[model samples]
Target: MNAWICNSSDGSLISFYLMGMPFLPKSLFLPVFFIFLILYLFVITGNSLILVAVVIDSNLLKPMYFFLTNLLVLDILFTTTTIPRMLSYFLLGDQILSFPACFLQMYLFHGLSCGEAFILVVMAYDRYEAICHPLHYTVRMTPQVNIKLAAGAWLAALLIPIPAVVQSSQMAFGTMTQVVNFFCDHLAVVQASCSDSTFQTFLGFCCAMTVSFLPLLLVVLSYAHILVSILKINSKEGRSKAFSICTSHLLVVGTYYTSIIVAYVAYRADLPVDFHIMGNVVFAILTPVANPLIYTLRNKDVKAVISKFMSHWSRGYP
Candidate 1:
């Protein structure tokens, strides 16, 4: 019993040390680090401004904008959780994270990601109501209903990853391995486990399928129906306006889902590390940065609000 206890304690210490070590190549570090730093700054500033504008502009206070605000908030949380720490590893060379810290990062990262997926679904449904059931838009998408939907999305995201986290924490780490990726990704971390991970793999697969693929299918279906509805409208002006509203959403959703699917496929197929990294960079860095820009540039309401805000600031004494 005493020998067993000592071995267990030694194993814990080794796991702690492995979790804390930094792993990155010097040649590839600086460029990737700087690029992501710029992206992180842009994502935070852009999303924050969008959230503020949504709150201040009463005209923007509808179901669509409300859901958008939630999405902006989630994007901010998601990028901040992963990118800053990753940048620190490059800038300061402080690659070590405690087990708890790594787990925390993974939790927040996946939680918000999953939440954003559901939020996108909610947004699609909002658009559906507005386009298909125009008369019931107001009645169907009440403030209470919107709040519940947002809350449910968040709750589902948080709950879905609990099993994975628990299983991951319990896995034994036999001395020498380190996480190759910049962040503690679910699959990467699970692959390093010394215990039997069959159940963990299955659980993660289930979560990924439900959280990622199902929502993607819904998004595709929603856009398909939206397109059909737009085509039926007789007025050229009406069709043009409706298409414009959806264009931003389509671009953002397309970038997000495509990158995610590519990353998962590459990881599953054991592709080269560079390919996997590129996939993650697209999903993690580019998508969040692009989301605000896509909406602001393509959606007139956001552009108008931003222009008005900028004009107000420009004319001020500061």
Candidate 2:
């Protein structure tokens, strides 16, 4: 809870220039703004519908939907932290974000992202229990148990980014407050710090990788077990059906991790800053949309329940 000391009057510790696509010509700003706005709308609307459908459809009351509901909320919040302010910058051309606001944005973005990773790992466990240990799935994934898992994910996400944010907040900026990135990302923000942020940057990187990929490792392990079990099934139909349940989730996971890898690689490489920003913007906007889209198209159970829910809602609409 650091107080913002961005004294615009003194002009010393003022706002930082969020370098959003420096080469992007002014003429294309409107088009780009609308594009991002539409994608943001899609992210919000699509995730919201899935959230509502899961809540209303009694068929979806299982542990899978319980975890999905948490995912949707995380997706919504993840973008909600940055998109509005970004849209404002696009609309008003005010790319200057106060120091405190920038840090808050960074904290929320990293925290929610870490939380989503953890949730996906938990979902992998859910799928493992359902497919590999069906007889014990009931006892393993009770509603109360799912609630606890979701709560733990949220708590961990909220708490894990604190050290990073605190260190960033305490950093002193030099006369040059212009950050060469769209938002106050960890790398971009630290670059502008006047202090020796080597330790802070290292800590953030280690924690981020650990938080993001440790769960990914668990997901892979769970899926490996799932694959073994599926292969062991004697009936072809049983194998197909069992594998189907995992496909949608695997697709979403692939896209999510691919985006993460690409963005990190682009950011770390000596490529143009535009490349890095575009990689982050495109994927960040697309991730929330990915989950609901995959769920709707790949998961028969979700589509069936959603279709039924839509029909019922339409009939009741004035």
Candidate 3:
């Protein structure tokens, strides 16, 4: 047990002590703080730029960019939910999170994560339609339909984790308040509970499958259809163009799942607790940081728009 956990005479919980980068020496905390600070700033600035580009350019008023904007908003919220507190932990050595604040963090992080997964699925479906059924793509993915799809994803994400969070909140904390990670990750908080956590663990697993793998499966199926359609194109240039359209989204998907797998493996493998902590940290930070970079580099349209936006801003245009 960590030295921070202590007995409560009345068996009630008041706060949680976050163990931020337990493996790092005290002298290195400031450096890690600065590193995370930079990444968080990048995530905010990069995603915000993409969002602004999509908003200002009438050319980007389509289903794909709409979903892209949704994704950018989710990524921004996702990082905001965890990284600021983490920076405080690293910089000021303030690891104490009030009880309600800890659960709120867990709920917001998990909810935004779920929203991003589903938004990716929607993007894949949009790509599939554009590639496999180009004639009907516009009719099928109209603005109202896109609005409904995005709203449904956000609503499901907001509601799906309520049960697990409520159940976990009711579990007996009883002074076992040392959350093993820098953030209030679902499993870490459940484990901190002094009460029975087997059911909570299982519940978290089920929710993970529902939100994570289910969306991934949908994306894979959509891409499979897209691949079949692209293969039917007679001209090599046509095929290349079709595949290029998906490259950025595919890269985003790959980065997202790679971080997830890394975190999952670090937890399930026989590794040190520090590795487990770091794995979750990677999951929290990696995709949001990489997502804008991938889209900006891989998608010519986005790159051009961002470039134009930057030039206009430099010349004092609103």
Candidate 4:
């Protein structure tokens, strides 16, 4: 009768539903979740140690490390906002997120990312001053000037994502509410909307390019000038010493920019879901984890400070 027909229609809808299926197989969930959890803890602890070391050591209180401290803090903030929620989804097999929660996560994740990009540009400029104009480094990078630059970077990062968020908020959702990835990524969420997404797509593209490419260009130009200055030094030992100081910075910048460019290209081409997720995880999590190790291993002063701090902590605990 009528009841039988209604039950049949419900069964058909469930069979055809695309949004609710698990993207990852059950067998792979627990192992991947644990690995990501361990990586997240390492990122948090390592970056926090760097920030603490910079704050306490009097000798490390220069403008260069000041910028680095801010960068480390941003990395911590960046990873914290995205990774925990992703871990939760992996552990619980639950991907249901309310509308506001998803939007907030997207805004904060991209906002911190933009802030990190701005901070990297500032760090490159700090290196440029220290290497190319050694005599004026102290004068140009004074504490007050550093404060102003840091404030400007934070403000710029926060404002750049406003247009995209506003545009996304206007889109209407039809039958789809499930996002493919673990957390609510802004691009994926926007793509799910039923309304006209042309303007949103264009705005997101422009913002991503502006935030990623512009800082990358600045970093390259600063290092070009830095290399030219380093070559002018007469002694081989002196040139090696100078290059060592900047090598860590260069490695971090290279990893960050390369991963970001790959991700952008993949996103534009409509690549597979797994590819997109992997690219973002590399840029967001792996880059931050690598920053502390690169700086500590490559810089003698940082290593000494870290050793001293660890020894003090060990003695106090014992």
Candidate 5:
């Protein structure tokens, strides 16, 4: 019932059928739907609480929390872009996406994923500045500079995927091409194309590598300086305070890269298609879920603010 096309633009059937997590059996869809629905709720609720706390509490109005606000926004958008659609597919069999819609999802997924990495790097740089150059930190990390840094990270990330998405859009596709992943992931879409995918594949790898390791490299360098500065501090308490400042960010960075590496290995290994799909799914959900947890549990200031807010709300204070 689906039409095939020699060219992407000429197709009468301009839709994609998403096979949301092909690993699971149909009978299990209900349970899986419930599970992911809970996660989606957690992602929203946890990140929203932190965002609200940062906004309302004058204590959190700093360069660090400002960057955290950007990361929280990205986490919310990133999961929203994929999880709700995934939930629909699980619960209602709403798997089919129109051509434009599919590409848009793919673009947003990759762009926001890249944005998170850049923001983490920015956060690391903020830590480096605060620790390594405490006296000059206020002057260097002014509001204008922080704004520019956040804007640049987001702009560069959002722009980087344009060429790849545009090229992928031009590739040949069959009628109702079946995307093997839950969402319109870049690699999954490319593999579904009828056109030769070698160039696209390579381009994707190059972009992924650059996005993954380059920011990672920057984060490492920043921490290297942070470590040296921490050691140079004379008092034990001072050293401990400096190290504690970075622990939350470090945990987040570790979790983000670990998920990516797992996903990359799963994709590259001689594994089943389901493994690849699940890998990407984990990559999609894991970081966002872990980010809010890491910040709240590990960062004292954020935790304190969130606790105070909760108590105030429980008291029914306006």
Candidate 6:
């Protein structure tokens, strides 16, 4: 009886229950748990490596790398907020959450998530400056400016979710205790509340559109200019070199935006529970997994830094 209301019989509005991926078959538990355990390790290791590489490698300390480091930190935090609890659900069947903790989790997860969206835009702006306004790139995107931008992204994202959290905190809980998705995700919590969620839904919709989708649109607009600038390069090699830098970021942005959109749709629409659960998993789990790999594979500098670190480690061990 994971349901937590003052009176479950009438199901008024006191508490709620969590139905974390309820449709997941028992037969898939061990496999899914094992997979997520490995996935979590990969996320931590991968994102940590990106952060460390940017920190230790002086040559990698461009304005873009500054943003990359921030992105890595957000990725680490974003995955950390959800993945372990998901793992616990698979291994130990612990989906129960107190009202406070549940809402808190929702806040943190969406806050970090929204932070990542803005960081991606900042990263796009970094490239835009380097590509379009090469002469002023340094003057414009100085270390101090980069710090301010990163701080702004975090502050803006964290604050945007506050209204949702505050409203939900005051709302009465109805009979709908079971959250459809795993972990206490933002929309999941709001949808499960027995009380009317119109205000919060509108708030979240506006936030997603303005905070998330707007940044994505800016990224696309920036890259459109970048592509035009790259095409103007007379030498094919120069154009190729310039375009190569954006591929990883574009790929990451594509994956993240697509995952979130699909996931959100699944959650909102009358879709199957499996699609909803897997949709959450896609953006939450796979994006972190793909991020470091995309950067390391597509960018020579990251690969070089990784190789250097690995070589040093091997030498010490040898």
Among these predictions, the greatest lDDT belongs to 5
Q: Name the runs in model 3 displaced over 4 angstroms.
A: 2-13
Task: Report lDDT per candidate.
Answer: 0.77, 0.83, 0.90, 0.77, 0.92, 0.82
Runs with alpha carbons beyond 4 Å of true place in candidate 2: 1-14
Rank list by lDDT:
5, 3, 2, 6, 4, 1
**RMSD of candidates 1 onward, in order:** 3.8, 3.5, 1.8, 5.7, 1.7, 3.0
- lDDT per residue as tens, model 2, 88-158: 87889988787667888889888898888988988899999999999999998998899999999899989
Estimate candidate 3's alpha-carbon lDDT, on a 0 to 1 scale. Answer: 0.90
Give TM-scores for every candidate, taking all chains together and pairing residue i with residue i: 0.90, 0.92, 0.96, 0.90, 0.97, 0.92
Q: How far out, in Å, is residue 187 in model 4?
A: 1.1
Error of 4 at 170 (Å): 1.0
TM-score of 5: 0.97
Q: After superposing candidate 6, which stretches have Cα over 4 Å from the reference?
A: 1-16, 174-176
Residue clash pairs of candidate 3: none
What is the lDDT, from 0 to 100, of the residue 63 in candidate 4? 86
Model with the higher TM-score, candidate 2 or 3 = 3
Q: Per-residue error at 90 for model 3, in Å?
A: 1.0
lDDT (10s digit) by residue, model 5, range 177-210: 8878888998988888888889999999999999
lDDT of 4 at 182: 60
lDDT (tens digit, per residue) of candidate 6 on 82-104: 88888888889876676767778
> Candidate 1 has what TM-score?
0.90
Give the CA lDDT, 0 to 100, for residue 54 in model 4: 84
lDDT of 6 at 317: 47
Candidate 1: global Cα-lDDT? 0.77
Q: Per-residue alpha-carbon lDDT of model 3 for 1-318, expressed as tens digits?
A: 334444452424558888876778999888888999999999999999999999999999989999999999999999999999989987888898887888899999999999999999999999999999999998999999999999999999999989999888887664548888999999998887777789999999888877899999999999999999999999999999999999999999999999899989998999999999989999999999999999899999999999999999999998
Q: Candidate 6: how large is its RMSD?
A: 3.0
